[model samples]
Target: MGIFLTILKILGIVLASIVGLLLLIILLVLFVPVTYKVSGEYGDKIGGRVKVGWLFASATGNIKKTDDGMDGIAKLKVFGISIKKIRLMGHDDTEDKHKVKPKKEKKNKKSGTGKAPDERTETGNSQMSDLENDLVNSPVNGLKNNTGAADTTGINGNVRVGETGGKADSINGNESFDIDGESDINKEIDRIFGTGDETPEEDKTADENSGKTADEDVNKTADEDSEKEKVGIIEKLRLKALKILEKISGTKDKVLDKKDTLIRKKDHFIEFLDKPYTKNTIARGKKLLKKVFKNLLPRKGNANVLFGLKTPEKTGAMLGKVCMFYPLYHKWLHITPEFYEKKIEADLWFKGRIFIGSMAIPALFLVLSKDFKRTRNLAKKI
Candidate 1:
């Protein structure tokens, strides 16, 4: 019985120790912060480094430009000992570095290349035959032979002028088709004016009476044109007055619509401001943002910048907007802006700590709050 009691006491102590150890580990994981540093530069070259550390473990990575391309490397360490180091972009191949180069062969020009005359003659003859066959089978040569024309062009110098609408254009100064198309255009003009050779026999026979008919037709057309001009003038005036009235009515309606929209928007904004949920949401959001900025923003940083946006006014405006966050970063930043030049130069470094335990709980509460719920439900806001 004493042995059994002793064994039981030992088991109880062991179990308690295990439970305490687990609780300690959980607390450390939840409360321990992750520290990080970021650094970068520009102008001569672009480069940067990022380092993140937690307790005894840390990882560092850096990138920089090279003659070939961007090169990057990363390293992992634990307890001040490097566990792994590797090239993040590409591996350093050692085989090429250690390779042995072959000795260059020596050439003797004393024998004048040491080739047989028959072989050289055969190669030259083959090249000559190939050239002759190419010239015989060429498309430009075929065109010259078929057309028997001196204006045939080679493949490179194709000349084309402004001819379209299914009309063939001159190629390589060949104006035969262009002349045919122009003649066709002239024929069409003559036909439309009743001067072509295809004029009707009846029209030819009636030429004697054409003078009197033409005079009467001219008088009749003049009277008709004057009446049409008067009608067109009255129509244009009526259309102008109607268009003016329509424009006025349209403008009035647009003004009234805008006024009604403004009134409705004002009323809605008032109601939104009066809601208790909205006030609560704004207050909570402001508090959360303050906490986030306090913890997330770097405690120490310096930025030296020579910048311009092509004009002094634009450069000042940009700097003004960026300086709004001066209070958050405090006095660690050093910036120099150039309002004259268009070039940009900068060197920046920042370090910050993120305590997940401190930021997570408030964020979780905010997300689960009734105000957040009301805001998410559009019906409640409306």
Candidate 2:
């Protein structure tokens, strides 16, 4: 009997220690801070850091763009000891800078009055008409002079006048007097009006070269326009992708805000639980507990629980009712009892028996027993 009592005392101490350790772990998990800091550009620059913990902790990295490339560093620590460290370096293409020339303004020619110059024909009709009149009047004047010379020559022919008479007679004998005059007039007309004939080979070649150059210029302009259109399309796609990313980031920020609100609410509830109990505190606790449980538990026909435990006076009775009526409790006990109003006595042989039975017993069994794999296989079969 003495040995048995000693064993029970030792077991009680071990269970109490385990319960304290578990509570400490739970407190640490609930209270430890996890912080993050992010600052930098999206594409041209980027950097961030994240830290989790109070004592046994972990931290993460930062990366940023430089003039030449990318550089970064990351570190991990456990129990104030560096467990892992990493460094990163990379390169990216740099932007190109180009010199741009300013455009020159075109100058418009102006007349003496300062208005733009009027269009004028380079070949004047008045000058051409004057040239035609001179051509017509000169033929008549040459004919009159020839006839007068003929009359003089005839008069000299009768007298046999001198060397001048001899030259005039020789001109009349060698050629028809009218033929020479007509030949001179034809030559003058030909000089004034060019012959309607085929163009020269040099002029034709020059025209063909000009046409080819114009076609080449048109093709080059078309190619440049196509390239510009392609670039514009690429820019539009890039902008669209950026817009989508912005929308996703906005949604992520909204979710984070909601999560932060929930975390704050949890912290408030924990603080409230640490305060002394009173009528107002109990009422507020009831409300907070109902809200939390409503969120955690499934609702019945769109309605959460409308009732709560009134105070510590009724706590035992409420727990008893829950154990009696709750489906989970009935399943665990594998039995149902008739309704009754009798007081039920509950007793524990050890001080930490509740914690040992609920947590340590199952945990120790899993760690020590070799039946975990068999149990897992059986669960899978089920």
Candidate 3:
């Protein structure tokens, strides 16, 4: 009975400890601010590192473009000690991809299961000798083996070079070897022509078609001229005048439409300026914008920048627009915009931090503002 009671007490203590640990973790997650820092440079590509830590753990990673998809690596640390690493964005393929491969060692020809150099040469020489022997035993090569000069007088066709007036005789049809400069070229040309006519048939056909095609073209041109003669000068003049009048009338109608549209736009803009809501709306927007910046934008920040636009007038106009936001950002933002040059070059570094928990009340106030609600409703009506 006493052992049972003691076991129960131990179990109760364990349960209470687990519950206390859970509560402590929940409180830490709710109250502890998760801090983050981001820093990088910008040129042709955008690259940066983001570090986020809550309580004791943090992650830092860079995401960039890749051939297949996004490629990134991150390190996770616990209590300031690296506990794990993310490879190729959570893939196991490691840094070995960039490592140089060791070259393969060339094997010795005399190694195990391979023939030595002397034996290999002996085998190659024996093979060549055997091939020569086989060729000598053949009937065709027997004559060459027994005689130095080749026998030309055979059954297929006799060149009869011993009797052809010091010239090779034609073999099989009119084919023969060129012993001298004047070969069977004339006979070959005659065979290709296959006729005794001075001019070839192909040239005769081409000449025949040439005159016929030229005559047909001239006839077509004459027919076109006769057809054009059927139309009177008065009819052509009337058609050209009609086309010109149509183009002029179309341009005049476009001009009148543009003038009417401009007049309507001018009158509408003037009426909008005279309304009382315009001034109220502008003032309300400025007030709301100030509140939003105070809540969302970090007041403490630093940046270095060089920027430009296409033209000097455009640069000045954009500069004024940028100043409407937190005016102090100009001090840290060493902004030099091109006034005369027309080129794009950017060198930028920005660093800032914002507390997510601190913006709660200001966000609520901005959302519940009477003017913001009225403005949204007015926009819907418009």
> Judged by TM-score, which candidate is best?
1
Worst 10 residues of 2 by lDDT: 346-355
199-279, model 1: which lDDT tens digit per residue?
Answer: 578677688589779989999999999999999999999999999999999999999999999998788778777888978
> What residue pairs are clashing in model 1?
none
Off by over 4 Å in 1: 94-290, 309-330, 363-382
* Clash count, predicted structure 2: 0
- Per-residue alpha-carbon lDDT of candidate 2 for residues 248-365, written as tens digits (9 for 90 to 100): 9999999999999989777766655454432334454455555444343322111111223345446556656766666743322222222343322211111100122233334444
Clashes of each: 0, 0, 0
- The sequence of per-residue lDDT tens digits that candidate 3 reaches over residues 140-178 is 321222222333543355543321225544545466553
lDDT value for candidate 1?
Answer: 0.78
Q: What TM-score does candidate 1 reach?
A: 0.46
lDDT of model 3 at residue 5? 100
Comparison by TM-score, 1 against 3, better one: 1
Scanning candidate 3 in windows of ten residues, the lowest lDDT window is 139-148
By summed lDDT, the worst window of 10 consecutive residues in model 1 runs over: 142-151
Per-model RMSD to reference: 19.0, 28.3, 15.8
Better of 2 and 3 by lDDT: 3
